[model samples]
Target: MSDQVDVVVIGSGINGLVAAAELAKAGWSVALLERNDLLGGFIATEERTLPGYLHDTYSSWHPLFVSGPAYAALGEDLHRHGLEYRNTDYLVTASVADDGRTTLAYRDPERTAGLFADSRDGEAYLAAVNGFLKIAEPFGALLGSELRSPSTILKGLKLARAAGIGLLRDTVTSGRAYCRREFHGDEVDHLWSPWLLHAGLSPDHAAGGLMIPVLAATMHGFGLPVVAGGSTGLIEAFGKLFAELGVQVHTGTHVERVVVEGGRAVGVVAAGRRIKARRAVLASCTPTALVRDLLPRDAVEARFAERAERFRYGRAAMQIHVALSEPPAWSDALLGRIPLIHLSDGSGSTGIACAQAEAGLLPAKPTVVVGQQHVLDPSRVPRGAAALWLQLQEVPFAPAGDAAGELDTSNGWTRELADAYATRVLDRVAAHAPGLAATIRAVDVVTPVDLAAHNVNAVHGDPYGGAGELDQSFLWRPGPRGTVPGLWHIGASTHPGPGLGGASGHLVAQRLLG
Candidate 1:
């Protein structure tokens, strides 16, 4: 490999991969470095439980990627290199309460609204989603671009004129409040409230009112898509594209520090070798890590470093993969066909769980994200068998105690504790699917500690980089331009916060290329 390149990208997450591929395609020599042996950071697929069941280890859905500008740029290339997606045309997702009431969401908004009890709620639901769609282009552009840029200001102005005062008011209102004001029925809240967790927000958090409509519009427009074979298929496709573009990939290479001279980032010292970067060095890492560990103390201002130190992380997360002997026998037979379902009862229950997790206690009834990947892609499991990708977003990294007071929290996230929590989550699922416990052949649990150990970017087991509070989001988010010249920052930690969007990386690459 050459000792020098046009750009040196640190970390091989979705952000790093996108930046490297885009730059290399633009005829710039790029080198991508990864600490792990594998290239994909969070996106991985493995047979966690049984040989035939292929499970997405971390993130599964791709609604954001399919709808983002990154996909608009690279989707054709990725598809050419063996990237295929499986999506349902009708049933996308649903939510079920303990009382066996199921609220379904379809690809068609009118069809989904028809399921609501009150006809007014159906009308309100349609209005909220369609209202957002009218300004979706400008809103999406503002989120995808550099927030502090002049172009962003114009986009925001355009959006304000189109959306009026309601958009501004919704930014500060909580999802709970938005649902209460918009619709009398609990159906809309029950279906979309749990989705806030995916954005690193709670049902009661600010900006959720805005996010709920965005989520509804996205799911309805794109549908929930998973890669054809596994989530790793996207990574494999990127690998093929990288090779075709002549991008150098160095896996198992830990970049120790950025080499700065004359207040400019010239390269990185990885594996005790100094590989020079003639153009730029993009670090796909947490702001704290970039300011504290990667760069020299004198490279950045002290206040910036201190602010990075204060970068708060939200609640921890856990993944439970279950291999079922057969499909779960849900009490509501319709639930068996939905791609994803949440065990939540709107803000009333989900709010309590978020509060408990923040207070360092295990939630008694945590919002469970049940993903049925096999329903969209039958190749994920053996014929006549199934698997469940269960996600627990409302979890404490270090539990003070269990809210149910059943598990021992003396030891933080030990194997026994994780197993006990897994049992609780499964029991919650079993409530909706009476035969769930009986159908399980094997269960593999990935606790918060496991998440932290697996990916350095997942600080404190927060897979979304950092907390997405109003203070840390939008114009306040860290931009690509760092204090040091030729250094850029991208990833979940940057603006356009988390999810499978890859917006941060795409934004940074466009900045460099322009």
Candidate 2:
């Protein structure tokens, strides 16, 4: 009994951590293993940026800040955990056409509406948000409720209730349709379109995608907040819980393979050692990495592997972080707040950006996100210095005409690509913030290939697991079943898409327990 435990989880990312945490909370001992030198998939920190600067290597904003059960459950009361979130309540969104028309979304929607009073769309903004939230009520319940019931009679009722609420139909429409029908402004639509990226689809595709409001509600409920340190803080908080719970979180360990016997997972093999477990095995890695590399081919059904391969991994990002002496000055007060920014001057920019990789066009003006992390959390940057992350879409995982385009881990080109991407952000932001570039002291960049090489969870450089479209949802996600009697999967790649909410992790674990 001493040699064995209740469960063995591979990868210390949020999915693995949460699965372990949930099981341990239920009085089960667990042994969690991470291949990487550290824990937390994308919610990680890197000192590589500079000596004192701590950059959230992947992401800083948690759209599910309010609605995510992980944060909601964890609450502000860390109880000696030393974790706190400071929110930047202003969204400085602008369209850089002949006229740089910028709109501000305040913590207060009414105030956000004031910035657009002259525009008809501005007046409708509040109402549209209200309507979206109103429609979201039932949809929220549908996502939260257990879709499975012991009896078919109960399951039928759940289905009926969901369909009656118009959830079924709306979820079957594209994001473009949803936005066109709900909001009446160009910028509002531009602002709302970011949600489509979550699903890994262009707004134009008739892919039956309508999950924008859930994301909006999550962000609105709590402005996309970040801890004072970085994303690593969130992951470390879980590590702390694992320690208190006595769950063994081993770092710097590489899991070579998943140990399976008699048609069921038994444990894992790492560092030429076999760590056996009696309870169960949970894989928090990518479907491809888990199946192709970690697990034996025959152990996992070929159909499952095929499905995992077929799954669409969404848009790639070319990211850059600048260690600046001063905040970039903008055409407007972009320095004031706003975690994410959008572009607005294309026929179907949202959809076009989504299809750009396939179409072979590096968009003239791609969706650019300007996240001034140091502005929101000063602790992340060195004293008298700031860190700004600027990421552009359409930077495909496998770009054409590049030798090391997809997951380029071969040469020194990754850091170089990162630098080039950073320069673009500096220039674009400088377009409005004329004085911004002059203040820059140092820059750190992470290209699409860099992201994939670093985190096995984000295959093909897509940060949000698989495509969050209608085709890869709920039961259809990854593969069949929430938990396969002895196996479990969780993370941003799974159902409910990515972000800090850890709601997917909670649901996956809850499903296992239930």
The C-alpha RMSD in Å for every predicted model, in order, reads 0.8, 3.9
The true-versus-predicted C-alpha distance at residue 171 of model 2, in Å, is 2.3
- Residues 1-514, candidate 2: write the lDDT tens digits: 1347878877776657667887787888888888787887677677756788887777677656446555555544342476667776665333343246665556667766666544676666665566666646555544543444354345445555644645555577676786676556565555556555545556765443355555454556567677768777767677677777888877777889877788777877878888787767777766767667877777767677787768677767667767777666666665345565554442265566556654543444456666777767878877877777766656667554322243332343456545554554466677766777778777777777778877877777777776666667665665213323466666666665566566666666666677
- C-alpha lDDT of all candidate models, in order: 0.92, 0.64
Top TM-score hit: 1
**Window of ten residues with lowest summed lDDT in model 2:** 401-410
Misplaced by over 4 Å in model 2 are 76-79, 89-98, 114-128, 135-138, 144-166, 206-209, 401-418, 479-484
Residue lDDT tens for model 1, 92-136: 999888787889999999999998999999999999999999999
Listed in order, each prediction's TM-score against the native is 0.99, 0.87
Name the lDDT value of residue 52 in candidate 2: 84
Candidate 1, residue 246: how far the Cα is off, in Å: 0.7
